[model samples]
Target: MDARQRLIETTRELLHERGYVGTSPRAVQERAGVGQGSMYHHFAGKADLARTALERTAALERERAEALLGDASVPPADRVVAYLRRERDALRGCPVGRHTQDPDVLADDGLRSPVEQTFAWLRQRIAGLLAQAQQEGSLRAEADPAAVAAAVAAVVQGGYVLARAAASPEPAAAAADGAVAMLEALRTPPRAPHRA
Candidate 1:
């Protein structure tokens, strides 16, 4: 890759492996195999490089989510299940969600905006899918789409934490299974046929 691309990719990896506080400009330059001049030429400084990398990471995550959640051929509930069960490196934690714990990233509005906006969009998108399912009589009428969406989002992030803490992927898998089971319970029962 080019110098600019290498710098961004290296910063992205560093940010994921180490939070903003730990990813020094020198480390980025060394890892990227680019000179100090190359990095400064492309980005004003470390924060600038981090922000750019973070924005790219956020966009990639959103795109991946959209692929599963936006498939019209699949049932809405199934779409949600697909998202929950999507392959993840539970032990490694989420690329974007991990940033929520970073003080430096949270403190800077510029750094935080992409992370905040990505999650908001995820919840909103999931809620829309749930609402659609409710309208189609697939989901229970009494179920609240927005509330369920938030819970779904929570479960995924929580699952990651649980997995990381336990040093096992089973917790994340179990959490996803539990979420799918809950969704199954919320599905509307089919009507009995009328006697002739």
Candidate 2:
């Protein structure tokens, strides 16, 4: 890869492994194996590079989500289950959502925009699917799509935290299973056939 791309990729990894405070320009330069000149030439500074990296991470995450949630052929509840059960590095935490814990990233509007926007888009997208299912009489009409979407999002993030805290992947897996069960419960039961 070119110097610019290398810097961005390196920064992305550093940011994921270490928050904004830990990902210094020197660390990025050393990790990228590029000189300070190359970094400065490509980005204004650490924040600039971190912002680019965060944006890239957010985009990739959105793409993966879209792939799972975008299929109309799949039942909406199933789509949600697929998303909750999608392969993830549970112990490593979310690439984009992890940034919300970083003070530096949260303090800077430029750094936080991508993270905020990504989550907002995710909740809205999931809510849309739930709404569609409700309209189709597949999901209970009493269920609130927006509220459920937010809870679903929280469960995933919280699952990561639980796994990380417990130092095992089981917590995350259990959380996904629980989420799937809850979603299944939301589906309307098939009506009994009538006898003459």
lDDT score at residue 10, model 1, on the 0-100 scale: 95
Kindly list the per-residue Cα lDDT of model 2 for residues 1-196, writing each as its tens digit: 9989889899999999988989989998898899998889888988899999999999999999999999888988789889999999999999998999999999999999999999999999999999999988899999999999998999999999999999998999999899888888899997678999
For this target, which candidate reaches the highest TM-score against the unseen true structure?
1
Q: Cα deviation of 168 in candidate 2 (Å)?
A: 0.4
Backbone clash pairs for candidate 2 read: none
- Cα lDDT, all candidates: 0.95, 0.93
What local lDDT score does residue 120 receive in model 2, on the 0 to 100 scale?
Answer: 99
Per-residue lDDT of model 1, residues 1-196, tens digit only: 9999999999999999999999999999999999999899999999899999999999999999999999999999899999999999999999999999999999999999999999999999999999999999999999999999998999999999999999999999999999999899999998788999
Q: Which structure among the candidates has the greatest lDDT?
A: 1
